[model samples]
Target: MSVVPAEVLPGGARAVTGTVRATVTAELGPRARLWPSLVAVYRAQLSRARVARIPLLFVATFQSVGILIMMRGVVDGGSEAESVVAGSAVLVVAFVALNLLAQYFGQLRASGGLDHYATLPVPPAAVVLGAAGAYASFTVPGTLVTAVFGCVLFGLPLTHLWVLAAVIPLAGAALSGLGAAFGLLAPRPELATVLGQLGMSAALLLGVLPPDRMPEAVRFARDLLPSTYGVEAFARTFGADPDWALVLGDLAVCAGVGVVSLAVATWAYRRAAVR
Candidate 1:
């Protein structure tokens, strides 16, 4: 018996009878079937992530409350508009960054989850998508909570609201990609946590604090953070103003990080131990 690869097309037709065609047709099956399968994989992966990250979620919730308390004091004396804008913008970035750190560590555990994917026939992109999806579920919702609290506490407007919603998920994707990339540089899980802390501290010193207040060198260093633009996006949303240039720039940075980090992650993952 001869084994030949055949790609079946719609209507009992064959799209490719040759060596497995490189082209994957998304339209081959009924449209409804593809998404649920992909989403199921994503959900399964996310469940593992969620299970491992209960402590992280608890900590983030506590941190969010603490920051809200701090911002309440700090936002005093500012105009209502300015207070909400400033508070929400800063907190949103912090929230997203923390979420990224949590998700990165979840993935970093070397817990054989990464290995399981290595054996699957599923595409690598699917793996990345699933992992990112799982993390996004955690991070994106927190931003909403942060935003609403900012609004109620500081009178931040939800005008141009869709932009606010968009920023969270966009930041989520970018941060998850960055997390995968950072995971490559960190060889150990503990090291990853330390590095994430140091990185966020740096981001906070630069983005949360005004640059004018920082020494030149410290301010200069803040330019390296991926969360800066996301913070700006949050601020812009509060103002109901769209900075198209900033949006494009953020999108480009996200694309660059996702592509480069995925490459590095894939290589590093190949070397990752799987039991």
Candidate 2:
């Protein structure tokens, strides 16, 4: 039988609610309700997962902070540490890129969890939505940790605190989408790593290192990377102190790419799984 739209049963559970109730409810309860119960069940599941993963999350955060601190030391040295600054630039590009790939692919393979989602009554779209929310949630704590480390080590200022309000999330989401795109296409870990390196190279070529310094021929090739928007947003925010539109436009473009890529990936996964 074809998969049916899922509905919530009593006690906050979801079941495939179709005409063929016998087969569907034989495994999942029949007489399922709708949204509220489904949401409740999802929330309970998420709570349990967050609780289980809290310690691991903390350790990762601590490690990331240490990495940022070391990078920051090189960052604030100004021109005296030009090489360090370049390294920091490369590191940020790498950091942003890795955050996306690590979470997207690592969790799936490490936990061997894709099949779990395949077995659920929930729509495939739901997985992507949940993944997107979780990815967005990551941006919050990650940004906070990076910020604290930046201030403590490199002495990054909050002179224009509003700049951060607009900058960090957009950059994170842009990078996150690129990471997710890689996972959708990557068949093996080595291939994923290669893609990740390609992402870094593209970022450095177009964004982090500034295309302006490169010849027209060079920038032409790197223009393929979606990261230029993020870099431009940050650069304008700090260097030119231009209008808010600069960052907003950049963020919009980044978000547009992310949304489109996510949609395509989800569609591809669903068709492949159903086959």
Candidate 3:
């Protein structure tokens, strides 16, 4: 604290003495790097949501499995069966990555949870990606189970099931980012929930069904969805002679979409955090 003479007025008359106090701001350490911050947030989110996500994961798996069972009677082994199996597998990803993630972020935003994260030193992208990755992680077991069950139910060859290694991350990235954007951008949490449900419903209707049976307009709409590329990549593997090039092409599309969507989600995270 210090004492100072008051400034003279416009009339050249000095005022009274003044006291001043200086604030010594504490310097924070350097911000965490992207990878390390991402990992930290990922671990925190993963550990925190493990128990809560298990039951929802079970439901996702069971729902996909039930779809497989129903489709079993409708479609004997063929391309249709391949489509059904692939779609059912990716549907697990959609359920957790898209639907539940949207709900999570919506609730977080509504409850001022973003404020806590906003105060952290982590990048907004890391926060968004970390949460998305954790929620997506919960879908792995469900996806695998659904895929295996679908294969067995439809008599599809399991030789290329390993392609799931690529499909999961790519598709999860795309869906989770979209979910986060929806949650963060929505004016209300309930609206966010509706958007998530609508997105999942679109996945279920457009993805699980055989595209050939769909109207031309509907097929066009299917082409726009990111998860459908993953489904296509996975379904292509079920053929007696798999087209590796086409499979890779579909995966590439998914990868591209994932990158774009996640970037958009990061932007949304920033926008939401500032508010």
Best by lDDT: 3
**Residue 59 accuracy (lDDT) in model 1:** 61
Ordering by lDDT? 3, 1, 2
Better of 1 and 3 by TM-score: 3
- Candidate 3 clashing pairs? none
Q: How many residue pairs clash in each candidate?
A: 0, 1, 0
Residues 146-183, candidate 2, lDDT per residue (tens digit)? 44454445444434435445555555455655565566
Cα lDDT tens digits, model 1, 15-73, are: 66788769866754332343555587688767865677667655655565566667576
Per-model CA lDDT versus the true structure:
0.56, 0.51, 0.91
lDDT of 2 at 74: 41
lDDT of 3 by residue, 160-232 (tens): 9999999999999999999999999898999999999999999998999999989899999999999999999
Which predicted model would earn the best TM-score?
A: 3
Instruction: Name the regions of candidate 1 deviating beyond 4 angstroms.
Output: 1-38, 49-55, 77-113, 240-244, 271-275
Show the colliding residue pairs in model 2: 8-33
| Candidate 2 residue-wise lDDT at 260 | 72
| Model 2 regions lying over 4 Å from their true place | 1-103, 106-112, 141-157, 204-206, 239-241
User: How are the candidates ranked when ordered by TM-score, highest leading?
Assistant: 3, 1, 2
